[model samples]
Target chain A: MDSGTESASADAWDGEIETEIGHDEYDPYGTLTLIGIYFVIIALLWVFMYFVEFLGEGPTVM
Target chain B: MEIHRYETIWFAASLLLIVGFIGTITYGAVGVGVEMVDDSGGTVDPDNLGSHERFGDTGVHKVNESHYEVNMIAVHPSFIPSEIEIPAGSTVTFYMTASDVTHGFKLVDSNLNTMIIPGQVSEITAEFDEPGEYGFVCHEYCGSLHHEMAGNLSVVPEDEWGGVDS
Candidate 1:
């Protein structure tokens, strides 16, 4: 059962590469975009936690 | 080292993020005046907590017009003088210690949080500018009724603030 699905999926990419792309021409913009989004999320969370949960909590230690 | 432009950008961004993180914490400490519970409370003998000067008489004491000191003791499943009452617009310094085991003291909705070890003391000071009620709990699990280990802190209006009710 596993061999049939494996071979069928493997055959789809069995063809040779039509064009070769070198490292200098490749750009991982997608990874950059993903990391940028993650950074924004983390920064937002830090602001909320620090400003709202911590500072806005009131009666903080002096 | 030869690095790609994208890698360089990512590296610079990462450095900025780290610096921003440190700057935020510094601002909190310096600008906002956030403090940590330290060894200022000093040490005590767990077995002789009853003989301690402050811990011996666990309750609220008025230092001056704007300052107050609260001496508290934490046992297995309860806090001595659990119902703490104080006046609003006052600064309070909580002196807490545990007699049996280690416990945590965390005032809900406030930054008044610390740990109470058997032989060690935890001291934290905070300013209550508004009149409100805060619930404090033992964040550490000590025994069977650890969840039930909680207390109430009432910051009443200055005019309505009566001395500690014996």
Candidate 2:
């Protein structure tokens, strides 16, 4: 283990490169999934609030 | 600039969401008949409310069948005729004005809400569908006792409704 004796370099790193994904190929499936879930939740809440809560509570100004 | 496919989809989705929101609001305004409070209630001299025709005698006025009118004044920490009783299935128009400063009137559990401004009458009309007890509060911060500035609205059955006190 040549700890500090070896100068820090890209080649000196212990990790091995597996596969590289380019910007075009890198599809953020996790982020897209999360955002989709959030959109669904927000849409559901909006429908419930506007239709069920507000519209249902009548005696509104006509 | 080149955009990612997911980013483009998200952008389009966002635009659709915005349009959907506007569409919902339009539907509420046009189809559902939800109206915003406007200056249609006409203006009034806050100082001379005492001698004014309607405000001179503030209370509920029966306007023949299925219609009623309420003349109310909002003072520092109380509404004149704080407890208002009306019949169910009747349309009531409220004409309100503030003598001192600006105050807010928001009826709990109903869509009747407006700001009472000095020298200007805040008028709003609402229908009483069911018989129930509803509370109204001054939402605006007026004075030290603003928290206690509240009132009650009583919607009684048609048969139980006693005509306005002469």
Candidate 3:
């Protein structure tokens, strides 16, 4: 093969694989789902602690 | 700089979280009418605490029909008038000072906590809605017997409460 053709083949064999996916088209549905769960948990804990642990624990200072 | 949509969303969520915390605290202060301890208790001389007017007669006193005042002194190893009795369903203000070193007063299971400095009086006001017995401790490490420095606060019923006269 010619030098240019050989170089091109070598570049292809160097572990570079082309794909149809683009950076902008990458969907992070899994990340969004995990973060949504985290948000719900944090909100619930906040409510429980504020209402149950704090306000319910009476004899507080006025 | 370019930012991802998810990053922007997360940033907004973090801001909302902070604002939510501040709002909750504000509601507790304004809506629930929770007050904090301030410098209104004034100052006193640690050396002459025995001769001071209020600390000299350290005990619980009924100020009015619904209000009470407690004058307390934190000495080295114990509190003067170790047992404090007050009436439930009344507002009680604690005026405290330390004689030798800095100390701490923390009423257990309650929100009353303050530092008792030698020359400064620490004051906190709390209301007891139910008759119960609570314990207080010197939370700050001042001396060798700091761990043993504790007291009791008894909130008795209105009918069972013997006022300062009794």
Candidate 4:
């Protein structure tokens, strides 16, 4: 997907969660799903860094 | 058969690169428990030592009094002042800063790996314990020309420096 759609979904999730926790609105409509997606992305990045050595030990020909 | 030859050569070259990368990382971070010195060295003053004139030397940079100061500008695949010769027992402080991106500053046979941020000077010091040819290169992959960023450092004894036998 394009970067714009990805970011829009992320921001929309954050907004929805904030609304759910506030007194003005109580719409918990699957906001936890957004949080799960965020965690998944973070975990994937951690794995990539651990094995691929991305930008850690300088540059490699391989 | 010709493709096999190419594959073998590629494999060999890649193996050497891996070895070099491992050496760089080891020298950069291994066996150093103490805290690293803050890399900010003295501010750059071209007129203080007239160092601006020494850029792009073909490997034997002539500095005065057998002792000198230098600024190794970070660029794609290498440091700006690529090759250098320093006298033994003297500390050569590298005033490093990247012009392009974040590059790794490290020395072979010593722990000097540091992140050189773009537009921010990071000072690193190195003292050669033995007079010999030491290999060093930028461990950070900035671009496709990364292999060309390699260079050699020669540490000569004080007596042999400046053509003086003393």
Candidate 5:
């Protein structure tokens, strides 16, 4: 079964000018990846410390 | 066979790991400790940066004793809200959510340090025992203007509030 509105919307075409100006030169992937890795490590350490906080000892940053 | 620059890469990685560890613990302290989550068990709202609203009227809010709510939206790079006004010597709950990336929310009066995740909300409740000018910061790494994400909260005397400014 096909709804009239849905089918009409799919077929309707009005050529629209793209308003977005794309940035093709910038690549932040590597930076983001590095940052992501950094936080993951810290989160693991915090989990380790949360349990330890109760014992009155947080891990030293050596 | 040509192998070169490997040492530099290793050095960088090591440095990055060390820095990351220090940062993460700070994050866990502010984010994990509070069990900071929203009504749906998810801290982030998938659409907006952190306001829990995907678009339009984005950002966190606060509720006063008289039940006056203020919405903090689109904080600029300076990390400071352009303006904040609250009744003096009153308890105002701050609800913060980032509209883009991660931002740190802290209050000078309360020393609140919390990481607000994009698409998630981080909430903090603070009481201004005395009326005064208070400033805040975004501690998390957000962007080129990370250092600039700052805002302020003002505490005014109860009488200062409009009589019906509930």
Candidate 6:
């Protein structure tokens, strides 16, 4: 029964799907843009925290 | 196996982020001259604290013109020298230990924080640039009245600073 269904689906779907481009050709520009923005935000926050928040709150231990 | 271009880029970016974090910490330590608490002060028997030289007489003492040493003890619910006074623009080294249980010493709104262990001494050096009063509290919960374990650090102006007792 499993072999029958597998064969039936294989025959039905054989020419139904078409690959226009390879996976390697895909460029995730949106992901790169989003990550770049996130990186900038993190860097800015780190600077604000280290310099403004930490160093600003002085009388610090050496 | 083939990897995507974005995957390689992301890997490189991740490496950059890690390296950047290490660089920042290194800069803070080297450039900013931030020191960390360590075991340089050595160990002591908490039970025999009364015989110990420094912890026995726990208070602030002037080392020289620009340096001072504060020997402190943290017991159950209080610091031995509850009130501390120092001159402004002086480097103060706090040498502390615990008698009974473990406790924490945290100078509120400052970077001065360390653990007080029974058999070990915790030492931290701090520099106060201005004359002001800073409150400190034991952040680690040790006993029932842990919240009551608080103290004050007063940095007095240079003109009004008193010399150390002999």
Residue-level lDDT for B145 in candidate 2: 99
lDDT of 6 by residue, B31-52 (tens): 9988788888899999999999
Q: Write the per-residue lDDT of candidate 4 for residues B1-166, one digit (tens) a residue.
A: 2344334545775576567657645644554322355634533332232344322222233345543555677777777667677777665656666667778766665555677666456765555556887677778887888767767767788887653121
| Model 3, span A1-62: residue lDDT tens | 69999999888769656777765577798998899899979978998898778866766667
Superior by TM-score: candidate 5 or candidate 6? 6
Which CAPRI tier for candidate 3? Answer: medium
Candidate 4: which stretches are off by over 4 Å?
A1-62, B1-35, B42-67, B163-166
Candidate 3 TM-score, C-alpha based: 0.88
What residue runs in model 2 are displaced by over 4 Å at the alpha carbon? A1-23
For model 3 chain A, the run of ten residues with the poorest summed lDDT = A15-24
- Which tens-of-lDDT digit does each residue in A1-62 have in candidate 1? 89999999999899999989876677888998998999889989988988888888888877
What lDDT would candidate 3 get against the real structure? 0.87
Candidate 6: stretches off by over 4 Å? A1-15, B162-166
Task: Decide which is better by DockQ, 5 or 6.
Answer: 6
lDDT (tens digit, per residue) of candidate 2 on A1-62: 48546656544877877888776798889999999999988888988888888877867777
| Model 1, C-alpha of A45: deviation from truth (Å) | 1.6
Docking class of 6: medium
Error of 3 at B64 (Å): 0.3
Maximum-DockQ candidate: 6
- lDDT assessment of candidate 1: 0.90
Q: Rank order by lDDT, top first?
A: 1, 2, 6, 3, 4, 5
Give me the runs in candidate 5 sitting further than 4 Å from their true place: A1-62, B1-70, B74-81, B162-166
The TM-score of chain B in candidate 4 is 0.59
Residues A1-62 of candidate 5: C-alpha lDDT, one tens digit per residue: 46988878877865686664445434456766776688677767755755455223321111
User: Candidate 2's error at A8, in angstroms?
Assistant: 11
